[model samples]
Target: MPYSNIILDMKGICKTFPGVVALSNVDFQLKKGEIHTLMGENGAGKSTLIKVLTGVYQIDDGEIVLNGKEIRITSTGEAQKYGISTVYQEVNLCPNLTVAENIYIGREPMKNHSIDWETINKNAEKLLDLRLNLKIDVKKLLSSYSVAIQQLVAIARAVDISKGILILDEPTSSLDSNEVKELFKAMRKLKDEGMSIVFVTHFLDQVYEISDRITVLRNGKFIGTYEAKKLLRIDLISKMVGKEFNNIESIIKKSRDISFKASEVNFVKATKFGKRGTIEPFDIDIKQGEILGFAGLLGSGRTEVAKLIFGIDKADHGTIKIRSKEYSYIYPLKAIKEGFGFCPEDRKVQGIIGELSIRENIILALQSSMGIFKYLPMKKQEEISEKYVELLKIVTPSIEQRIDNLSGGNQQKVILARWLATNPQLLILDEPTRGIDVGAKSEVMKLVAKLASAGMTIIFISSELQEMVRCCDRIFVLRDRMIIRELIGDEIQEKNIMETIAQGGISYGKN
Candidate 1:
């Protein structure tokens, strides 16, 4: 609570990219022996602040004080030298190597000019079991354990390497409830031992549960820092987004002018659609002007179903009909030509082309549908990009700026603009709101609802069950690559969806 107890203090921090001010005179302070969480929406400079502190990026102008002394960290090695270590969401470890080797890697103990196998295994096991309460055979391969376990192993290694300060970035994003509890337990143990931790996560519940202090940042500026218990969740969200929280009802009010109901006409229909080793054969008829959702955990065939429907992955067997026209063969180009657009789950890998300008990225799908023979002129491309930028509220300095210069939320909007340019009858959005901040998520969901109400059919897939409940008109529950049940009307609530997934009940004779 007082500067007297602060172990790490960053003052007047400033980091700038080509056309973006990532962090502008931002300030962050971490108390000794406490868990401090950095909070913000996408592009709010959370990652940039962390990178500057961890030596991934040297600060253009700032002063970093560690242990009451000024320090300049120019590399990861220097950060570690200053007793700062990080464990990212994706565990950066070798799956082929044994846990012991991974923990001590690069600094393994030696015996008579050879590696000391027994001491390494013994110490790794003792450190994990005694320090973190994680009991596992250190001789086993890293891949033998689940993601949760691998995360704990990473923490164990980080603590062993440098326990003064540890940074956990979205560690519980992929873990189950039980695994998250175990992680919290370990974090508490570390904090009790006088280790200060810097946590960065999008999940509010986890932040409030583990953090002693919460720091809010917006538009590359320091908002404030308050004790976790003293900060209300709503107030914290407001600070992060730089606005009061608006409920889903307020977002949908914009589309209230249009009727929000499923029409009798079928937009897309699949009879016994099946993909080998991906998803089971299932019959589905997506009605016009309806939001059909695929709800399930990660790797529950949600993306697979989207892929099959969008012709990204060919269906091994099925009869597909689009607007009552039967199609014996399907592919991406054909799907596009037939008035279908898809926003893929991984925007970085499958969606956005980083080096391309915002204007070029937005016109890609439309140009593809028009074919190279009918290439759009530069003026048309600029007009289309500017139109969507205004329509979708995309924040950009210029349309000619590279898409990579924009933030995560803006990048997602560019992808959505690409699809909207095609004027598709149906849009397949797979995790469209994933990885973005809550504010961006609200914008995307509002856009989805608006489009559906305007007579566009949507097939949505998301891991966030609450999002599916709030946005979907009907939800098809899947488990283990099989369609388990269909939920509609009053049945499309979060509790019911969870129960359905847990019970794995057969519905429509599909499972």
Candidate 2:
């Protein structure tokens, strides 16, 4: 297990923004031919470290050594020149273009002043067959294949172009179990052939499965590095969160005190609510002033149910009633009109408008819900933004500043503030604390509990079993787009929820 060579070494790295010190004196080491994992909670500087190495950011301090020599990467092209390539979660490729064109688009060979289609396709096919062992028509449009295939094509593109380091940033976020295996297969193939890989993901199972080493960071500071086999999973999580990993019972017991079961007239009732070909028909009643949680695997239909409720996806069947207001089909506008607010899973894509100011974004939901003509005064907007900014402790220079400049945690708080401004009867939060620090997650969960106590209904969704057990009064167990079980009372525990998800299937009638 001795590492013969250190292919890349980052020493005393530091990165900072206006109010946030992203990384401080952090050191990362990547061994030649070894798959190294950058482990931490969201905002743990995992992405920052990768960015500094990949020329996405100019380092404030420290040095980068590659292949026993110093190197300065100023841009993506320069990073590629040093044989450092990256494939982010969202593949930076055109779906409308052919697979071959996507693979060699910028680096295509010119034949008589035109792109040589024959050479591009032939080389792409060779790379797919030889290295990835993939058998597919390179001439086909990239969108014709699944996300997993596109992920592989992305990796194939990187592998064909670079020889030094390949960074995969949460590449399996959208892939199913089978697709993840295929990705791991390709990663293993690369590792065996002496390609150093930097993998950043929140999934623990994938960590032990694919990584040779893991470097832990906390609050933008390097904690330690350990071999994959040497570190225990619980200990690793503890290090990342900067807390002990033995408080499940205490957390659940605390959740029990904030109860809504004493008096419930059913806040919202869905009768056979379903989206055809998306989620199966199901019935459930969410109580007033209660935290309802959805528990499942990556594609176990957790997000789908939230979408159906928030009207992001229209339901083909069933009826929904919010506080006795009935609707045959629920969509976002109707849901919002009838007192519903949604914080989507993908914060970057769907939640916040980056170009807008904090003041503008905060009043968006309320403004939209009140109709466009019911304009909020500029003074009123500043007052609301300033109030929530202080309440949620959003780190921003001023309310008029653009939202894109803030950190992930601050941005999440802004979205929460936006929804709270609407004062909706029910809130649906999907992965509300996915990529933030442990402190921010605690704050968000506490806020959810406080809001529910203040008579706001919440449907919480998260992949963390511990968080689900700790926050939810009742959990709906989903699998394959169906609510298999509605867990309450003693069934709401980490062990039970996991077991229910792994051992049970969708077999119950509409509940």
Tens-place lDDT digits, model 2, residues 77-117: 89999999999989889999999999998899999999899
Those runs of model 2 whose alpha carbons end farther than 4 Å from true positions after fitting are 1-4, 110-115, 246-262, 269-285, 293-308, 313-329, 343-367, 370-423, 429-454, 460-511
Task: Put down candidate 1 lDDT per residue, 296-414, tens digits, no spaces.
Answer: 65556788788888889889887789886887548899999989899998899999999999999999999999999998999999999999999999999899999999988999999
Off by over 4 Å in 1: 1-4, 245-287, 290-340, 344-348, 353-423, 428-454, 458-511
| Candidate 1: Cα lDDT at 49 | 90
- Could you tell me every candidate's TM-score relative to the true structure? 0.66, 0.74
lDDT against the true structure, per candidate, is: 0.85, 0.85
Model 2 worst lDDT window (10 residues): 254-263
TM-score, candidate number 2: 0.74
What's the CA RMSD of model 1 in angstroms? 8.4
Candidate 1 residue 62 C-alpha distance from true site, Å: 2.0
